[model samples]
Target: MNYLHWLSPDVDLSGDKAKVPTSGASFVKYFQPSPPASDPPHRYTFLLYAQPADFKMPKLASPLAFDLVSFAKAAGIGEPKAGTFMQVQG
Candidate 1:
């Protein structure tokens, strides 16, 4: 599985700022996996939400780090499920 790191638009990817902080990690490290199969590799996902907004994820974390949706939920600043992203595969 490939590792992924995400940051809100607020965070800078310019490499001039400090490194980003992780809210979570892979499930493999946290849970047991099924035995290997004669099948293609499965895609496992790790989702990380930013900490509450009144507080920041962490300094030097992401100047712009923090998911707007998650932040809204954590802060109770907006309605739930107000927005979402969608994709269609051909």
Candidate 2:
């Protein structure tokens, strides 16, 4: 499941490292990772999808049931341009 989601079209992608867009971005969902319950812990994934200027974000009732495939189908966004994951235990 996704722990956080943010979108920003104004962000400059040419930099050596990630930086906030000059126009700023909006968070579809806040970052909230639950305490790991397993020995291996739970994996949290971050995805960076290229949002078109005409892209319309679908209204989600709950993030709990959020599915990437379903979301892409609804939002009409293409495959993720970048992504990463991590397992956190606390």
Candidate 3:
């Protein structure tokens, strides 16, 4: 989906291993897995956010959105809003 006013930074995106300080707002909570079995199937879910289209990314890149909120604010996306979600089956 295309939001008409979000800006993103020009940076190399990587895995969560590169932990940025948690904003608490932008993170995983209440994550639960399915029922038990002889060999439980593996499963995972994730939430992703991006800047709106109108905003323009800065020259310097940010590792996480916790810091990027400042950038988003400047672009006019305001407090980053959570988008739609999807579910995965194991």
Best by lDDT: 2
lDDT values, one for every candidate: 0.37, 0.66, 0.39
Give the per-residue lDDT of model 3 (tens digit) for 1-90. 111222223222377542433334322233344434554444332323454556554443433233454545565656533444443344
Clashing pairs in 3: 5-52, 5-53, 5-54, 6-51, 6-52, 6-53, 6-54
- Error of model 3, residue 67, in angstroms: 1.0
Off by over 4 Å in 3: 1-53, 61-66, 83-90
Ranking by TM-score: 2, 3, 1
* Residue 84's lDDT in candidate 3: 48
The TM-score values for the models, in the order shown, are 0.23, 0.72, 0.26
- lDDT-better candidate, 1 vs 3: 3
Better of 1 and 3 by TM-score: 3
Candidate 2: residue pairs that collide:
none
